[model samples]
Target: MAKSDSVTRSAVLHRDTRFVPKKAVGGKGSYIFLEDGTKFLDSTGGAAVSCLGHGHEEVSQAVINQINQISYCHTAFFGTEASEELARLLTESTGGKLSKLFVVSSGSEAVEAALKLARQYFLELPTPQPQRTRFIARKPSYHGVTLGALSVGGHMIRRQPFEPLLSSNTSHVSPCYPYRGKKAGESDADYVNRLAEELDGEFQRVGPDNVCAFIAEPVVGAALGAVAAVPGYFPAMKAICEKYGALFILDEVMSGMGRCGTLHVWEQEGIVPDLQTIGKGLGGGYAPVSGLLIGEKVVEVMDRGTGVFRHGQTYQGHPVACAAALAVQKIIQRDNLLENVRKMGAYLEERLRGCLGDHPNVGDIRGRGLFWGIEFVKDRESKEPFSPETGVAFQVQETGLDPSHGISLYASNGTVDCTKGDHVLLAPPYNVTKEEIDIIVDTAGRVIEAVFAKVNAA
Candidate 1:
């Protein structure tokens, strides 16, 4: 209908080869419109990037205003007011523990910067703690595709192809996935202790003295279907990191900036990460932007020693990006959108539970705030997952976006591990209304039922 068939026939190597996306011509509120005037609710915010939703005039105007004054300036020669203000807002939001901001153009860049900063922190120590060389992260995790971030990731499927090129200094422990990893009768406290112990063991195996930092997602986004760490998990993990003299780095690229009902997911866990990566929602998809907030301890080490961080990007603090992100952050706070995130998030969870909680194929409904995931299973009693060969998650994603359904939901495979289970994620915008939540759940439910019905028939 949009006449993209000709473009599809061209040489563009898209992310997927099977289908070409309908051209998005415009958007309003929560829905995107195509050239043919077809409207589809953007439930997942384009992989959780559009936090302010689409067509935010204020964000656009802010970007324009900054560009009019100073479109771009090299970080080496000059600093922009927009960049300075953005840093101030982030520092204020985090209560001043985060004193430094290293801006980049994408989530992967932010992750890469965080990792480099973590390792560099040790290298620049007064005593030059050379033994602090190892990095520890959790399994079933995703940081990014760049070499450094990829080296630290635990998604086997994504890592397998590049295993030879990955760093040997990185090690992984189990994720805090209660549905798959928790024992049948185990208490939450016990489960958390078990995970902490596992993390400690990995540190010991790698020689605790050699560990530089421990990285994890406060609420895992793409890699684990929005799985959250259990209560007290971060506190325990933070304690272990302290024991080993290791810094705590949390990757909140897809879960930060009020998406998880808080400014930072670690706040809910009752612990703060020493270095945190934030993206996606920061610029609200207006411009590509991501940044790392360095904690006071790390700042103190740098301040006492080298007094200058070693890593930076050409676009480390782009004025336009900073301006757009500043506007998005201000608008969110000004409107008290986080409160709506909490209220609407509760409604979303309830709606998801009421709609799909009892389905035999629906294995789990879990997450916090607006970030929710619905895992699928082949056998509910045994908690057995469908074979990856079936591609159940992909089927659900495809059918859910059919023109007849006119809805979109995020789908993911390998929810159990890096290659085993399947689930679909729903991360609607923080400002989503109750009616919007209902529509998303209802439309997604129909798609799930249709897919499983065919699976059962076969």
Candidate 2:
């Protein structure tokens, strides 16, 4: 709360209007300094956005350079080298598996644009698929908050308010959440087969060719709290999309850009999506940047037909944003941060398991690379999540915000279905040191223990 809780009548409406949050004056490396002179170690990097950490001189220089050269150029008029080079960097990173890039200012815009692009793609085909109007996504997933993205997103709490307004054409299936979704006797292979069959059934229910695309996150982010796909699950889903002639879309808005050890989470999953959305880490919080990576199939359609994508945004391909993202990507490559993510990700798992894995309330600890989550439960043996009224996850998160605990934790509720579960995410910067990992884990363990101690007493 710091000194902010005492204030009222803030002109700017915040996410939580009940209380004003502490004002963050500055940050560096893995820590943020508040106006109250408290220095909190940044563990989640503000929903896994600051992969390069806060206040990097190089990214600053890149943005400054681009501003000096030329800041904004509408894509409708002219193209800037900043956007062109950024696109080249993104596409080439895919090894030409994806051939085209469309940039935007945020993840929501990228997803909204991707949906429209998918629609346009079907329209421009050698044989147009005017009937391909629907989308299929997994439950407890989040793409973004924009109307179209909201329509595809399965986050119940987020979508509930706008349900009547959201597009009715989209539907949802079960995500590959092994901790809760798996049956008592189910093997990993059996669980995957079950999910695959479910997806295939949904495609059949909707009429195969009527679906424009099936979108999912490579690693489920805020909505499910860093839930990665089970082995063989993605390839199986892609096969269904292929059979239906529907595009496969991976929304890596929170998992890609080297957050999950590899440059792309699909690199580990062994299947390429027809469309991919990446952000959060793209500009490392230096500037607003998100993008759509288009596969060869759709690009071919656009190239042969209209030679244009039907979607456009005022801030698409923003020069300053592209420049910041370019520097962030280049720094990642030059510094060999992906290797650090792999090495540290393993150690992070080890540390978390050692410190908190056996906690009575800690039901599951899961994730890959630098992204991880800890799910809380009342009965560990039964995997029974605490009632949402308890606010177990956010209580632990709020405890950490105190200057005494001095660590940041990203909280998620409704993990079990949008109303019944709780978990917290820990996504540090790629270049985080082993020492920093020790501090983060140690502090987080203490914080979690402290909060749950109070819950038990109450």
Candidate 3:
């Protein structure tokens, strides 16, 4: 859609005000059709949410059937079977490590729930530490948009407009970004230790007794692209949290629920978090759903104390959403899609490197499972990023979205700090085939080439 002549007539506020966005009319399998008849092969799953892809009839029917059975009920009154069973499935998947789960309406709410739970867990202890009030997070990482979640988030650009509204108790540390933070001569183990010390230093600065939790994304999502941790990074961070008695949280809103091949990204890492947040793939875009998975420690404390979380959302566990998400998970397990994710994920890494590895502007290609990120730079040797003014990542994304190129990817910037780099992410559905992978890579390659050709000409 172009700049609208009657933009003021629109009542609904869209992300951008300059243009009227096009409408997607229908979808099936790996494709969605726009009202204007343009077909797009969704490459990044609309920010990695559509794991099962466009329209899986089973999921759709599940939602309809749930609505017919029972639509809404306050959590304070009754607990529905759908939400109860979905919660059980999630907890069992963790092998009872995370003994309980709380369902919410979106990733942001799920994160907000985690932050609140962490604070309450401390107060519920036998010897309550009322001084624990601060949170420590990592830079260039995103959790969610709610006030508490945003306060913990370190994405500067997103936080700029709402800084006054965000809490001041939260501080940030260096992310485990090996591409940028790792020194030229440093070993992986040394790098992990260095990051651990930075986090430890922050806890000391804030007064360890005053800290409530240390949170981070296992695989940093949109704000920094799909950047995973180094070999021992997670374990090292968890140790630092233990030293200061702060809860450890892993926000996997975009990297959990089989998005990264395993059910949870932390499973690949060597640690289990005290609290975890998951969404995006939970309902496979069929319904609005997300969750906060509570580990045994947090659950045991709450159980022995007030026995209330002190938080509730009217739609915290909507029946339709739970039903849709349950159906989505069942399909993935029944069809063995995670095995496919592992196989295709390796192929995707190989193909991404094969297609753009030699490009002068390609700086790094890093990821795990079906998730990947391609960092762009002006000089590969120096790893110098393109000017933020160029908006290189968005340019590539928009060019690919054109009817001719026909691919939709997720674009991200400020990878260097909160304002300096560019990268695009690719997170196709978990069940995506080898042939579909070829088309996505080929389209991305061509789009990159065309965009740079024009830039060079200018």
- C-alpha local distance difference test of each model: 0.88, 0.92, 0.91
Which consecutive 10 residues in model 1 have the weakest lDDT in total? 1-10
lDDT of 3 by residue, 1-458 (tens): 22345667777687787556677899988898987688889999998999999989999999999999999999899999999899999999999999998998899999999999999999999999888989999897888898989999999988999999999999999999999999999999999988888888888888999998999998888988889988999999999889889999999999999988899899899789999999999999999999999999899999999999999988989898999999999999999999999999999999999999999989999888889999999999999998899999998988988888878878989999889999999999999999999999999999999999987677
Let me know the TM-score candidate 3 reaches against the reference structure.
0.98
For model 1 the local lDDT of residue 61 reads 95
Q: Which ten residues in a row have the lowest lDDT in candidate 3?
A: 1-10
Please list the residue runs of candidate 1 whose C-alpha ends up more than 4 Å from where it truly belongs after superposition: 1-8
Mind giving the per-residue lDDT tens digits that candidate 2 earns over 1-458? 44366447587677777778888999999999988888989999998999999999999999999999998878899999988898898899998989999999899999998999999999998889899999999998999999999999999999999999999999999999988999999988899999999999999998888999999998998998888878899999999899888999999999999999998899999999999999999999999899999999889899999998877889999999999999999999999999999999999999999999889999999999999999999999988889999999889888999989888899989999799999999999999999999999999999999998999889
Candidates 1 and 2 compared by TM-score, better number: 2
- Cα displacement (angstroms), candidate 3, residue 267, comes to 0.9
- Candidate 2 residue spans exceeding 4 A from truth: 1-3
Better of 1 and 3 by lDDT: 3
Clashing pairs in 1: none
Tens-place lDDT digits, model 1, residues 320-385: 999999999999999999999999999999999999999999889988888888889998899899
TM-scores, each model vs. reference: 0.97, 0.98, 0.98
By lDDT, rank the candidates, best first: 2, 3, 1
Model 2 clashing residue pairs (backbone): none
Ten contiguous residues minimizing lDDT sum, candidate 2: 1-10
